[model samples]
Target: MPTTDTTTTDALAQVVAQRFTDTPLRVGTRTSPMALWQAGHVADLLAKRVPGLRTELVGIETTADNWPGDLAELGGKGLFTKEIDRGLMAGQVDVAVHCMKDVPGDVPLPPGTAFGAYLTRDDVHDVALFPAASPIRRLEDLPQGAKVATSSVRRRAQLHQYRPDLRIERIRGNVNSRLRKLDEGTDGFEAMILARAGLGRIGEAGQRPYQLLPMEHQGKKVAVLPAVGSGVIGLQARTADAPVMALLDELSDPDTAACVTAERVMLHMLLGHCNSPIAGHCVRTPDGREFHLRGMVFNRDGSRFVHAAAWHKDPATAGSLVAADLLRQGARDLINATKN
Candidate 1:
């Protein structure tokens, strides 16, 4: 937790709680179970803080909602966010909730909109899940030439670097859908790689065999670090949308936001789009003013890579500059190659 004087911002929540004692708040989220789950979490938080403040969940369709297929082809993270952003700008929704990872570093949140609060982060590691019958218990424990499934090019590329002998395959749908592929046996994936945050959020963290892979960022292991914006949930509203902002300010986690902002700055500097095989994570000191970052980029074939790090007293600029350094040293080359 961040110290009060350094990064905490609860003033907004206090004002909103005082003002909206008699009105209901309308929040917007996607129709997916996970999206609804996030909205419910926000509603619960607001309900506890503001007595008798009614909250309603407004379901909106996104690119992912209408077209659920190979996310890689349709674009991965952004597909879930664009529609909700459109809704927010159109005044159809008061607040938009999102997985911070899915919100790009270069977010164009209309002119008057901003992300008010971010939830406390969860576990930020990659997990490898195997069939209940499989003997594999870790990344290194897999047999030679084992098949692994993942929809992320970043995961596939990294897997090749560490487990070149294993075959990487693409699997789609939500977490449960991908898990079913292994049980059904048609996918033939011996194991699958998924974000630890998602699993922890949904309470399935212990069901899988997780080997914390070392992500190349500075010199430390990756388990303690997190990808840009990993594990945090963002709540956005117009800057002038005082009611929504107040509710968000009350629920916002400053430590998580500062860390995520720094991480995202790195992503933005590297021009790391959703399609790229790049990952980064940021962490803040207990005081909440100092920040450290680790950024990684891999070749599409996963044969080559680069890792870099930097520190900042102010997260906003420090994170982006660290990422810029990585980009200058062949990160851009890898991204350009993917385009070609």
Candidate 2:
């Protein structure tokens, strides 16, 4: 066997770490509070990993951030990531941080761009927030025909399925704006559903009094499921940017990467679109030997749906198995119906 090179490898790593400290890495991201917090969090991680390394956040206003109308009508989730991706591709920024859920699964990443890392996952549950004066403390506390607001079709569908009499209204904006709207009684929204991770990132999860909507359906304990990649932050960089990619490799959590990869694969295989009411979640077993994936699909009104789950040693295989199972249960018909 060839002799090991402990000393040489250590020296090389020291050199690589020193090189990054010499030049600040430019990280592209949206201007929203949650987005800025996410970018700052990534920078903080890199700084901790490579002492003295500097990172600059380049905030860009995405179309989705500014658009007042429906995201589905504005061309879906890609709007949230498109400009930042373009900045990265044009060499204007060395890295781009994205909420993995916003990255479209129906299409491939832009040419020359690739995800460099997925940070450790965060809380995946959705929470219900009511106005300060409202008495509603949980989803079940809402009165019949109560109005609720959310931006995602997936949430809307699930809410309808959970409470058929509830009136689902569309609300869009950053976390702070949405909270303001809810507090001001804008559009008469009695409650709103938001990702718990997002609220945590923006420092509101702990400050606000909110109820965790049950992930599983009431009584039956069947999962309502979260959006694919809901709580993950993905770092994107040009494929040719070797040094950045190398540094990002240090930040990647293997377990999170594996689980999120499985969810994304399932979404891609299902051809889920912006309007598609689809949800998938993957988690590793406590023993860390296997992965489990659960997926759900619903029609526009949530009247019909299908769900499947599977476990495997390989993450991709687990996702494939779940996708296959959902398809067999008529997931395709539900997905296609949403597109029309």
Tens-digit lDDT string for candidate 2 (108-219): 8999989989998999999889998897777787888999998888988887776889898888889999999999996899999899999998889889799876677668
Model 2 CA deviation exceeding 4 Å by range:
1-23, 220-223
Q: Give one digit per residue, the lDDT tens place, for model 1 in 107-142.
A: 455677899998888777777788767777676777
| Colliding residue pairs in candidate 2 | none
Q: What lDDT does the true structure give each of the candidates?
A: 0.74, 0.86
lDDT of predicted model 2 = 0.86
Query: Residue 195: error of model 1 in Å?
Result: 1.3
**TM-scores of the models, in the given order?**
0.87, 0.94
Predicted structure 2: clash tally: 0
Residue 324 in model 2: lDDT: 91
Top candidate on TM-score is 2
